[model samples]
Structures are given as structure tokens and as C-alpha cells.
Target chain A: MSRAGEGHRVTMREVAQRAGVSVTTVSHVVNHKTEARIGPEARERVRQAVEELGYRPNALAKTLVQGTSPFIGLVADSIASTPFAGQIVHGAQEEAWRHGHVLLVTNTEGNQEAEERAIAMMLQYNVRGILYSRWYHREVEVPPALGETDSVLVNCYGRVGAGPAAVVPDEVDGGRRAAEILLRRGHRRIAFINTTTASPARSGRLQGYRQALAGAGIPVDEDLILEARPDQEGGYGIADDLLATGATGVCCHNDRMAMGLYDTIKERGLSIPQDLSVVGFDNQEVIAGHLHPSLSTVALPHYEMGAAGVRVLLGLQEVPAGGILTVPCPPVERDSVDGAAAPPTG
Target chain B: MSRAGEGHRVTMREVAQRAGVSVTTVSHVVNHKTEARIGPEARERVRQAVEELGYRPNALAKTLVQGTSPFIGLVADSIASTPFAGQIVHGAQEEAWRHGHVLLVTNTEGNQEAEERAIAMMLQYNVRGILYSRWYHREVEVPPALGETDSVLVNCYGRVGAGPAAVVPDEVDGGRRAAEILLRRGHRRIAFINTTTASPARSGRLQGYRQALAGAGIPVDEDLILEARPDQEGGYGIADDLLATGATGVCCHNDRMAMGLYDTIKERGLSIPQDLSVVGFDNQEVIAGHLHPSLSTVALPHYEMGAAGVRVLLGLQEVPAGGILTVPCPPVERDSVDGAAAPPTG
Candidate 1:
């Protein structure tokens, strides 16, 4: 193989020279332009020269001529948001690779003009389609530039009746499964510590909590549904209130919150499961997997959402316009929650 | 002023029609090809039409005509390796965008053929350069294909005298600062908990610890330096041994190790800063920031390393061949370490 000098790429002319053919003939053979007849021996020589020189033909040029490109664009509000963004990117990348496409990811960091510029860049690059995503689940307006491409939303939804297909985690289902984990462990007086942030998750998870209690034939206790800041400190801040409810087990808004509860409880001479079995949401691997006793939690299905978005964008899957597709949030069981915690003292 | 249907980008012909000019004139105006002698009136009309139509000219096409691209390629072993990948991507993205280049990131996940294919894709796309990175700091072989373009390594280095310039964290400095943090807090009998992993961090940090202690006029106690698996459980397992050293303060290999120590110490009826001051490395935001008292520790300088990598790759910074640029790991002060921890009773 030939090695190019610094700041150089082997050109088609190099291949033509090595192949003993005109540059135009080399181009036609390499591009497979059927009408541009080339002798068999010359075509063979061109192929050998290409392999030897490690010559890479311009995919952009081919895209212009053939009207397609093996590229997908992922435009996210922020890719630096840990755990969430990484998994989503991984899922989409794997799926796109399977379909012989590469992903061009650009993080806009929620800046309006940056988002538009990123979208414009994708179009200019001749991306097959765009995956408009968020690091968190939320409702968003479809950027007008997105209308020029086949697009799908991942981990977020477009406003009702005003956007393309989307794939988001089943938030309510995630909540119900978390509650069920504790309910099955014989904890009736369960509390749901929800985030104070007003988003789909705040409401959806709460509704699921209610459904779980109702399904278990336990009377709903409005006071048991507590609100916190949805972080470790928030969970710590609400610890006294959460413990005062006399719940045997609690479902935290997230792993961070669960971590906080763990600290206060331990300080209070309490132990997880023995005194209070706990479950958390967003099985963020770093926190959930490393916590003392580890955390049993529900995952947001970020990977699935990313993969599904690509499928929809590439026409491998079909969804009606304005229809929001949902993927299940799988429950991960670990050491934090258990089935044999004795009922709270009468 | 106009939105194309799905998969349709506004073409030069459309702009020409809207401006009442020929397509050739519109192309020339958008391409900024000064050699074309289009009249000012026609150029002005084309510009107005482009703005009104929300037209995005093909950057790839322009690259073909002008011999340059406004894109940088970043191929990492894995971008989904939380915390590390995200920050590196953020830093590189910001630097590239500042230079009018968009980043096309791909995760090869250490597959050799995939790496080759990714490099080929970048070449075909006419990328201005490539920023090859690893989520973790280590030595790597520069792929043969990388010789064909401008490239820089981030958080990793190539074999001696064999590849592009690199930016890596100053692991030795990170370790020394972590020990100094505890030493400045009036803790003389300090222990160092090092990871068992054989890497730059393990050896470099131990050297730093020795330097800090020596600088304090204290003799190095080899017995006080212990090794573990570089995780929370490892710290927990080594607590008895760590406690046996009569060290009032300790510097952990990383944040996860510090987390483990927190659990075991509290379980043994002890408190941080009150009984045993603690310092950790990595400063992983999720674990370090949310830990009970919040961890005071050293950072890995992932962000700065990433930004520096881009600067060097773009020729904005000069680095001698095979020189590994080191970014300082700044110490973050938090509540975990303090000067008031009572000396261990003899």
C-alpha cells in the first residue's frame, strides 16, 4: 500500500498512473459508470491500483451523482449529558452501521441558532435523514428546517399534531414497574418521591404510582406522593418527610435521589430492605451500579429509542405522522430492593 | 420563506428561478467563485433569493471545487463510555466549531476493520482532519491509515516516535495534588490507596504521592501504600487494611474508590473529615459531586485535554513530534478533607 505525505490523500490520478490508464478511464471504472465502456484488462488494473494505493473515492461526489449518501445526521440538544447521551448515541450508531451508514452527530447545547446551523450542515452534507433527539424526555417544537428531510424524534416527542414520528421511553410503565417491585415485596404503605420539575416524567411516573397502588387493592394516600428536587440533595432534603410517611418501601425519582436517601437512612441507624426497600429510576450505570448495596432501578430505554428512531428515519419501520412510538423501560434488579422486608411495626 | 417536502433540499435551479437568473449565476454567487464575471445586480438577486428560500449550499460540493472541507472526524474506541467521552466530544466540538468545522464523530469500539472503514469514510467525506481519541489514557498504535491525513490523539498516546502529537492528563501531578490536599489539612500520617490496574495512572499517582510526602519532610512508608481493583468494592475490601495504617487522611485512586471507603468507614461507625479525611481522583461529577459531603479530589483534565488535542491538530498550537502534551489536573476543594481531623490516638 502507498502512504501519502503529511496533509495529503492519494488521488484518483495516482491510481490512474499506477493502472496505466487515463484518469477519466480510471474514474469511470471506479465509479461503475456502465455506459463509459472500459476494457476488462484496464478495469482489472484500476482495481489493483486502488487496492495498492489505498485510494478512497469521494462519497460526496457519488452522492451528487447517484442522489443518495450513506450518512445519517443526529442533532441533539446536548451530547455532553452523561449516560443518557452516550447510550442513545451508541444505539443509533450501531443501528446506522448495520444499515451501511455513518452517523454525523452535532450537539447544539439547546441554542436555537446552533440547532439550525447543525441541521443546515447535515443537509449540506447530503445525510440520508436526521435524528432530532434530546438527552432527556420532553416536548419540543419541530424545527422548520427538519421538514426538508426524513426525521424522527428520540427520547422526546414533538407537540401534539405538529411533528414527525418519535420513539420515547414508556415513562408511566417505568414508574409502575418500580412500584410493583416494592408492592410484590409486601410493602403496602409505599411512598413515591417524585421530582418537583414539571415534565412528562413528573406527572407520568406519579400516575403509574397511583395505578400500582390501586391494582394492589391498597387505598391511595395522597400524602404519600411526595415531591423533591429529583437529585441527591433533593432526596436528602425530603428524607425526613419521606420517612415520616411510615412507608416500608419507597420509589425514588432517580438513582441520585435514591443515593441521598441511602445516606440519611444509614445515618439514622437504618438499613436498606431490612427497614426500607428502595427502587430508583434512570438506571444510570455509574451511580446505580456503584452505590452501596447497588440500586435496583428502571432504565429509560434510551438505546432502544435511538435505534428505533433510525429505523423510522430510514423507512425500515413505519409509523403514522404525528404518532409517538413507545419503547418499554426495562427494570434492572439489584441489591437495594428485596422481597422479605418485614411489614412496618404496627 | 419556503419549506421543501421530505428529502428535498432547495436546489440552485430553484434559487435561480426565484431570482430571475440562470442556475449558473446562482451557483457562482453561492460558491463565491470570483472568477465568474456575474454582474452585481444578478449576484444581489441570487443572494436575496437564497435567503428567502432558506437555501443551504452543498458544503461537500464546495469542498470538491475548492479542495477543502469544513468538517473534522473524531473516531474513538467508544463514545458511549460515559463522562469521559462526553466531555472530550464537547471540548473537541467547541474547538472545531470555533474554526468553522463541524465534527463527524464515530465510535469504532476498538474494531480494527471498523477503524479502517471509519478513516476511509472520513477521507471520502473530505474531512479537514481527524481527532483520534480514547476514553481512557493509554498507549496505542497509530493505525497505518492515519498517515494519510492530519490527526491528533486525545487522552492517549502513540508508540514512541511513531505517530501524531497527543494530549493527556498529568497523572503524576494529579496524584501529588491529591496528597497535598490532605497534607495541607494538617494530616501527616496519610495513606495512598492505589488501583491494581497496571496503567499510567497507577504508577504515576504513586510517584506523586511519594513526592508530596517527601516534600513534607516525612519519610515514605511503603506499608501505607495499598493496591485494589480500582472500584468501590475494592476500596470497601481494603478498608480494614487501610485503617490499620494509622493514617488520619487518605488519597484514593479515583472517585469510585472513595465512594467505597465512605461506605465502609460509616459502617464501622466512623465519619469523614471528623475521623478520617479523604481525597479522590477523577472527580467524576455524578459520584464525586453527589457523595455525602461531596468529594474533594483531583480532576483528570479530560476537557482541557480534548480542547488541546483539537488546537494541536488544527495547527493553532505547536507540539514537537512524539511529544505528549500534558494538561494540569486542577484540585477541586470540597468538604471531604479538612484540617481539624483529630490525630489518631496512639
Candidate 2:
């Protein structure tokens, strides 16, 4: 772990001396060379010492000697365009780099054919693992050939059961966080606007909302929920419908839909957090900041989700064999939500 | 070039016969493997026949057999939370796919050390080429060891004296487009609000504005141009400065700054395209559609820039070594601009 020009770092020689092994032997063990013929007892000693000293072998030097890679093949469904997809990539890259692995990204537009092509490209380069990124939470038909490789699906929980591990955000928790924020502001009559009921993100979020409401001794009213796309127009369309139902607060599935709702509220001659308080998800910065009143949203732990995905793929985390890991969601308060201050009694 | 399970597509065998070569030889050439001992005349003849027949080799079958990859490594500075970066990535991915190549992405966060690591990872994985994406147009210190590989820098150009090919949006053209859009709408006193003159994008854009004014026979007014960062508050500050000078139009470096301008304009009791006209660059979608008036911006031709970058790296296009290729910019006019009808009669 000692850098040539740096001080206050442990040297490989330290591990070698502690493990009672030659420097070359220590190097071989450190590099994880399968061909290294060290005795089991010596290997055990070196492993213990390496673990104790928290030694991280130089990936560059080791890769040069091995003529191969310690890199993970991360073919995102989309990198530049999709916020959710990009966040997953950021997380995976961070985790991979932290664990001495580098992530190679491919932007596939979530097409099965494109996904296969990306996977084949990864295989050609002998990438150690694969991470498939989807635009949102949905059933992704895992590429059949990925069984031989270690992979972690991001955002979407893949349906290919035994192929690769996956990391997905807790939409339910996101919904709950949204509800919690509204309830804490001493408001009830909350409405939910979702793009579609068939979507996992929407359904899971609804479940969290209902759970939160029930926990707070409030009735789960189906009449208050409005299904719509997570876009400005969709939210706008639903906003009037919800306002008609006499709801004072609303939680849109994601930020885009919330933006539409903001317009809807404004056009209806209603002031945010006054006539109707609003809470959105997926704290997208551009949309959040520019929206006249600024949007209050549930900040999905996208970065952490990405790091978790890579960690699971590297077998560094105890993710289940065929299960989804739901990351927690935290609420971000902005001007969108209103305080339900009592009217003057005069 | 044969596609199985489809009705009579031109087979590779036919191409071989037309060129007087074996099927295997045709396959080898199509797969980018020139290792075989084939005569130059025969190779040229085969190439002509394939071109004449418009043969598209089955990338999947070729990859399966020869293990040849068409994966280009995309090293983006970071797309985790940035909107513009994502657009560049989307554009690159689209173009890469058109060229029958998949892009692998790595976020380096503008860290040279991370860039080196990502490059080393790409090399270890044997990527065909590299597309280094930067957040801004500036001279970045490329990894010294990148000499062994071919690369194309995106959004940013390369070194003055040396290094990889590059394809960036024509900042001057974008600036000109913005200027013309505002002018066409009858905005005479236009103000240019930029982050800093030191920024290549800002400087290039300013040059474009000057060029446009010269074309229009309008005098260049230094008082109208103000330097500020491409952030919300910066735009607001610039807007405040521009309004004090009685400028009716504002052109910002990017959309984020433009958003700030909107806030400042609102605070000053000015209506967009009425009291003041505002146009922005980057065409960031979040602010484009969601903003009240919807920001008018100069489209950066992200798709063309990305595709052109791939073309440059794969030698699909003839661009000069150590030179910048500017992609054309077009104005997307929205609610932000209003035609300046005949001036009111005294």
C-alpha cells in the first residue's frame, strides 16, 4: 500500500515480514495469481496479515503483470440522457473504484438486442462483471447469456432469477418519506399522482404512502390517488382533478410529474404550500431549482444505490441470491409544501 | 454479411465470389482483422465488392467467432448529476451504435488520476478507441500514457500542439444562432452574460456574437456584455446588471445561468420576450420545457458532436490531427422570443 513518494503508508515489505514470506511470494499472493505455488499455511498467514493491515494491491501493476483486467463491465441502459440511469452508473463506478476495480460503461437504450450487444462487447474485453442499468423500475428480461458472469442490475430488479444480482431503490420508502414530510407539516388530505398503476415505481410508492397513512391513523382513500405519467403535462392534468376532490397536499411519483402539477396549481390560481402543498420524488436539480417556487422532493439515494450495486456484484455485500435490495429514501423540503396554518378566528 | 433466419439477404459468400475470394477471407476482412496474408489487390477488390453490394457483416456472428469487439470506451468526466454531460453521452451512444460500435463509459470527475485509471482499465479490457468527455470546453491534461491508444475528446478540444482527435459543438455558431434568434425577434439592445472570458466556450461564444453583430452591421457594445458563472445566482446577477443598462435581450452561456436570469427578470418586473428577451445555450431539457416561458436556447447538436467524435476516432471522417471540429448549432425558438414589430410611432 506504500506509494513510492509518500510518507505514512504501509509497505508491502511490512506484510511480507509479518507473514514470514518472501517479497516476491507476497507480491504473487497480493495479485491473486492462481498459478502462485505458495503453501496453504503460508498463504493463510499472508491473507491474515493482508486483511489485518488493510492492504490494497496496486491494480495497475498487478493488471500489467497478469495481462488481464480487474475491471467491471457496466453497460448502462442510458448514461447521458436519463437521470436515474446516470445515478446508478455513478454509484457502480464509485464502488468499483473503491474496491480496486474500474467500471467500463456502455449506453444501451434499454433494448434487449442492444443489451446483448453490449454484453457481448464486455465479454470480448474479458470484463470481470456486468451491471445492466435500466431507465426505471421495471421487469428487465435479463440477457440469457449472462449466467457465466457476475452482474448486478440497477434500478430494475431483473426477472432472470438466477443470473445476476440487482440493486433497486425503495420506491415504497420514497413514498413513505413523501407522506411523512407532509404529515409532519400538520396536513392530512394528501393526494397521490402517479403515471401508471402498472408500474412498480408507482405501485410501490403508493403502497408506502398507504402504509404511512395507515401508520398515522389516517384512512387509505383510493379516491385521493390519481394515476398519470411522471411528466409536466401528466402532473398538470392530474392536478386539477385532485384539486376538485378537495385535497390540500399532493405527492407526485417523480419530479417531472410534480413540475406539471406545479403549473396546474399555479394555473388554478392556487399558491403552493398554501392552497395545495406538493411533494415530488427523484430530486432532479434542474427541475427542482427552476420551478418558480422550487420543488420539494424525496431525494432517492441514487449514488449510494450505485455503490451498493457494484459492491453486491463484487460479492462484497451479502445480497440475497435472487432478491432485490431496496435502498432508503430521504425527503428534501423546499417551497413546494405549505404549512396548514389555521385561518383567523375573528 | 449473411443474416440467418431472414429471407434472402446478400450472403458473405456472394460478396467473396464477386471479389474472387473465399468466404473465410471475406469474413476476416469484414471483422477488421488484416492479419492474414492476402494480396493488396485482392483486399481492395473485396472491399469494393462489399461496398458495391452494401454488405453489412453480422457483428454478432463475427464477434462470436473471432472474439473481435467494436466497443469504444467513453470516459465522461461525470454524468451523475449534470444534465449537459448526460446529453453529450446520449449523443455519443446514438452515434456509436450507428457505426456498429457500443460505447463503454467511465466517470472520472475531471480528476487526472481517475482519468489515468479509467484509461488503464480500458486498455486492459482492449477497447477499440476512447471518447473522453469533459464538462466544459477547455484544454485538459490528458494521461501521458494514452499515447498507445486512439481517442476523441468531446465538448472540449485537445492540446494545441498534440494528442487525440476532438469533436465539439461550434460555440461560435451556437452563439451566432442565439444572437440571430433574438435579433429576428426585434431585440436590438442585446446583452451577453457569460461566466468568464477565460472559458473557451464563453470566449468562443462571445466571438460568435461579435461575428453575428458584424454581419448585421450593428456596432459592438462592450457595456452590454457581462461576465459571470453559469449558475442560477450568476445569471440573476448578470440579469440585474443587464437591466440597469436598459438591455432588452440577454444571451447566457448556458441554461442554468439563463434560469437565474429568469428569476432576476421576474424580480425586476420584466416579462420574457416582452420587457426582455432571453436565450440560452446547452438546451438543457429540464429548464427548457418546465420553465414558465420555456427557455429559448441554441441546440448544441449533441447527437452530431457525439457521432462525429466516434467518426473521427474510427477514421470515418477526415479531420486534421490536433485540430478542433465545430459541429453546427441551430436555434430552437420557444416562448422566450417575440417579434419586434415596427417601432411605435412618436
Candidate 3:
């Protein structure tokens, strides 16, 4: 441990004295208030002094005077532990830094007591606001301690008129884009493989699949829609049944499912696009990008949700109380989707 | 945004009034200094008042009196954005919380200016210590401003007598274990596939592999050793050459490489643990677990590295100046290793 200068804090007054200027001039320059016209040379000297002294205006002092520190708090269930959801923290942190505030995240890993304790710590830190986030999209009961500050939910929602605003990825739009890609590629018989679990992603994607079919003037085939456990094993378990339907195009619930189907279908003497064009959701880069053919899928917009959550907190974006800000999930085209049509073999 | 009670700070006076005790008694109880022996009834009342009022002792007051806040600062290159490295944050946070200190991380994405600014901010916040971390294992230059406080590097090393201590994963032992598993499984002829890129992981693991073979009295076969890109493509490209070596067991550089080898070798009509037993490193669950046979691989102690980093920072663990603590990487057994040895076929 390098214990040099432990517990030493350089004061603004020191920066002012080093720059040969009044403390008031240093304060105005540091905070960017500059109500009085301070000359450029004085401002440059103050900046140089601050840099040379490695001086930082005290965060504690700022909180004491302004009632809050320039810190945006993000408390999540498992954002730090869960790999796929980490982009949320990255986005929020980038946006917060852009706004001259630091973003601090505390992951409670779904422990109720930890959540409350983390929120209380944020309040003690005098954070500007809290971004209550879940690792995945779901309806969440806002923690009571969060009422002490301006907070908005990310990747989750709550009942109307009962909690803070939310920023979530638009599942329906994501699903629609997945199916429309196959539809526009001249594939009429598209199979929608949805999760067995009842959630916005499952229901919304199925609706979008059917909507795309209806728009194409092609009647919805009930047998073409298959239900699985929303994982690779589930996709593998339902593969034979899927091949029996013989749809030319397949839209999976997520990238994990697509990966499973890819393994099984390839094992059965079939290959993606050459045998059937496949589109997936949640575009998890590890599974999607590394797959043999490289899956084309709909992204989850997790980064956008995190940025939008900060925007909503900072009043840069609007969301009525209990309203949802559904960020768009754009399609990431890769090698999986083939424009050359294949024959249907139902 | 829920703006309820925004900027509200509950004070000791408010808690004293609610608990019917003097400010001095409340202060002693809150700060956990029991110099004045207070009654149990008074303590219970104070606890209740503190909980009900949510009267957290102001952080500024603590910093002013003690010269440092109860916060462990972790500044990393990309712990949050990089999925494999997130366990570092999780482990550090849990340890910090266990010691009644909060862990706040700032990801600078390896920008020098941002790194300096983040370090300066930590000084302003009066952090107890900073855990300077890198996303991957390598040598890192100690940031200049990091000299202001006690600091340690995580998963990276530095010049002795010039920088703080470091804690890194035991890649050599991990590689040795990977080969030992194959050797213990009654396999004589074994091939080790390492990354072409030169790094601690690459060199250390290879050294371990040679050591394992040497311990077993098996002569190292130069032709059996191959190198390629560290990803799946690299693994796949080397599969045919690996088969030509006539080795019954194959050790991979990482899980992604193992995945690539699995695809190609399976395509070539070979099966794991049956025709060839394979083991991988960096037990990335997404790839190693989801593969059809479920890969047996070495697990990187990312979580342990983080916890150890905090222990070093808090002076709970001894890491001599510029010393390296090599944490073990445990082997995760699955279906990839089969003890029922098959014949070596070229």
C-alpha cells in the first residue's frame, strides 16, 4: 500500500492562494458561475494552480451548501454481477459524467435489506437522484427508502400513479423488427419461438410476430408459434418439433434460444439460411457474434434505457408520473439472415 | 422522477427530541462510542428514533472530524462494461459493506485524463483507499495522482519499489490443473493449445502445462503444441492439426477456443470424452456450460481477486510492497472430461 498523503484534502483556498487571486474568484471559476467578468488570464492561473496542486473542490462542502452532491445514484439488483445488464451502468455513468456529475452504483443482488441500506447510504451521500434498476425488465415495487430523493426506475416499471417514472426497452418494437426483417427478406412462413414464461418480452414479441403476418396478408398459423423455457436447453428440447413445422424463417425469443436451435438444426443435417433464415432477440454479443453463422437479432436497448433513465432524472427527457419511456431496439444485421429464399417443406 | 423529500437531511437534534435523550447521548450511541454508559432503554429508544427518522449522520460531519469518509474507492478501466470482470466489483463491494464502508467505483475506460480526474475526485471525497484495477491481467503504470492515498493494483503488476502491491489470478496453476485433469484421466498423449498472443496468461499457463507433463515423466512433444487467435475462430482453425497429433486429450487456452474446437471437431465426427477428452480455461459459463456436452474448464477467480484487493486496501491482508498475491483458479468439472479413456487415433 502506498500510504503517501493519506487523509489530506487540498482546499479551494489553497488553490486561490497559489494562484494569487481572491477565494471568491476561484469559487466562481470552479463552479462555472462566473457572474462577475473574471479575466481569462486569472481564470487560466486558477486552473493551472488547481492542476498543479491536484486540488478538487470538496464534495462534502458542495453537499452541505447545495443540499446535494454531484452524484447520480444507481441501485440495482445485480447489474455488477450480471454480465448482460452491465451496459446499463456504463450508459448511465457516461451520461452522468457528461453532465459533470459522477454516477455511483450499488448492486444489492435482490436482497431487500441491502436495497434499503444502499438507498440510505445514497441519501447520506446526498445524491442528486436515484436510478432504481433491475437486471432485467419486470414490474417492480419501488423500495420505500427511495422516496427520499428524485428517482426513476430503469428496465422495470410499476403500477400507475404509485411510483416514479420508468425507462424500458420496447419489446414489441424489438419483436416487430425481428419478424419484419424476415418478412422483407421474402419469407412468408415465419415461425415465432417464444418463451413459456409470461412476461412483456414473451407476449409483446408474439403479438409483433402475428401483427407482421397480418400486415403481410398472410394468415397466422397457430402451429408455427412454439413455446420454450427461454433458454438454450429449451430451444434444443423444442428443435425437432420446430423442424416438423417446416417454416422457412424463425424468430427466436432471444440469442440463447437461437444458439440452441443452431446446434440442433446443424446436427440434423440442416444449416442456417441455407436451410432456414433465423432472426433472434436480445442480441447478446457473446452468443450472437460468436455463433458459426453470426446471428442477426433485435437488440435490448439496455444502454439506451440507462442513458434515458439519467435523462429523465435530469429533466432532459419527459415521462409523466407512472409513464414509461420505451427506448427503441434496433436490429443488428449479421450473417444469419439470407435474402435468397429457400423452399418450404411443411 | 420522485422528488419527495428531496434534499432533506435528518439531524441528530431531531433524533434526540424523538428519543427523549440529550444530543451527547444520541451522538455516543450513533457513533458506536459508549464512553458514557447509557441505559438499555435509552439505547433501544435511540435505535427506534434513528430508524423512524432515517437520521443518518451527515457524511460531511464525519469527514471533517475524522479526515476521511467510510468509503472504499475502486477506480477501474472497464470493470462494469466488461462482463468477465464484474465479479471484481461484486466481491469488493461485499467486502466493503461487511466492514461498514461503502464501495464506489468509477470506470475511466483507460483515459489518462479521466483517470487523473477520478483519482482527484476520490481525494476530494476523502476515500479511505483506492483499489486501482485493470480489466485484464497486465502491467500497469501507477497513476501519478494515486500517490495521495494508500492504493493497490488488482489483476496487474508494476515495477518493484515504484508502485503499490498487486493481486492477480494464478494462471500457471490453472493451466497445470487443466493438463493434470487430462493426465489423471489415463491419457498419455496430450496436446495443449495456447493463445498466440504473448501475456502472463499465455506464458504462465504454457509453463504450467510443461510442468504437469514433466511431473508425469511424459516428454514434451513440440508438434502437439499449437497456437492461433485466442477466440473461437482460432480454436476451430487448429482442430485438424490437433487431430493429426493423435493426442487423446486436448487442453484449450480459454472457453471460447474450446467452443470453436467443439464445433469443428464435432463436424469431423469426433466427440468429447469419448473419442477425445477436452478441458478449457477461464470457465466462461455462457460458453462452457451451454455447450451440448457441458465443458469442464478452469474458473478464473475474479471474485476472489476483488475481495483480496479490498482486504489489501483495508490492511486486513498482507501484500508486501510490490508483492504479488496469486489467487487460485478452481476447476469446474462437467461432462467434457471422461475417465473411461478411449484409444488414441491419428
lDDT of each: 0.85, 0.73, 0.82
Report the lDDT tens digits of candidate 2 across residue range B308-336.
88888888888854577878888888888
Q: How many angstroms is residue A277 displaced in model 1 relative to the true structure, after the best TM-score fit?
A: 0.3
Q: Candidate 2 on A1-346: residue-level lDDT in tens?
A: 3222211223578789889999888888877777979898999999988776645454434453564556688777766566667777787887888888767677766566777777766655556677776767777777754653567777776655554667778888888989888888887788888767477887789999999999899997888888886677678677557866677778888888887776556555567767777888988867776566778889877788788878877778887555778788888888877775432110
What's model 3's lDDT at B231?
85
lDDT of 1 by residue, A156-184 (tens): 88778876788888889989899998888
Which model, 1 or 3, shows the larger DockQ? 1
DockQ of candidate 3 relative to the true structure:
0.47
Per-residue error (Å), model 3, residue A225: 1.3
Tens-place lDDT digits, model 3, residues B1-346: 3222654667789889999999999999999997779999999999989888767777667766776678888887874456565777888888899988898887787788878778877777778889988877887778767777778789888876666779998988998999998888788888889898878999999999999999999999988898978888898899778888888888999888988888887777677778888899887746788887888899888888889999988889987544888899888888988774654454
Instruction: State which docking tier applies to candidate 3.
Output: acceptable
Ranking by lDDT: 1, 3, 2
Candidate 1, pairs of clashing residues:
none
Model 2 DockQ vs. reference: 0.19
**Model 1 residue B172 lDDT score:** 88
Tens-digit lDDT string for candidate 1 (B280-309): 998887889888889999988877877788
- Give the TM-score of candidate 1 (chain A): 0.94
List chain A TM-scores, every candidate, in order: 0.94, 0.78, 0.87
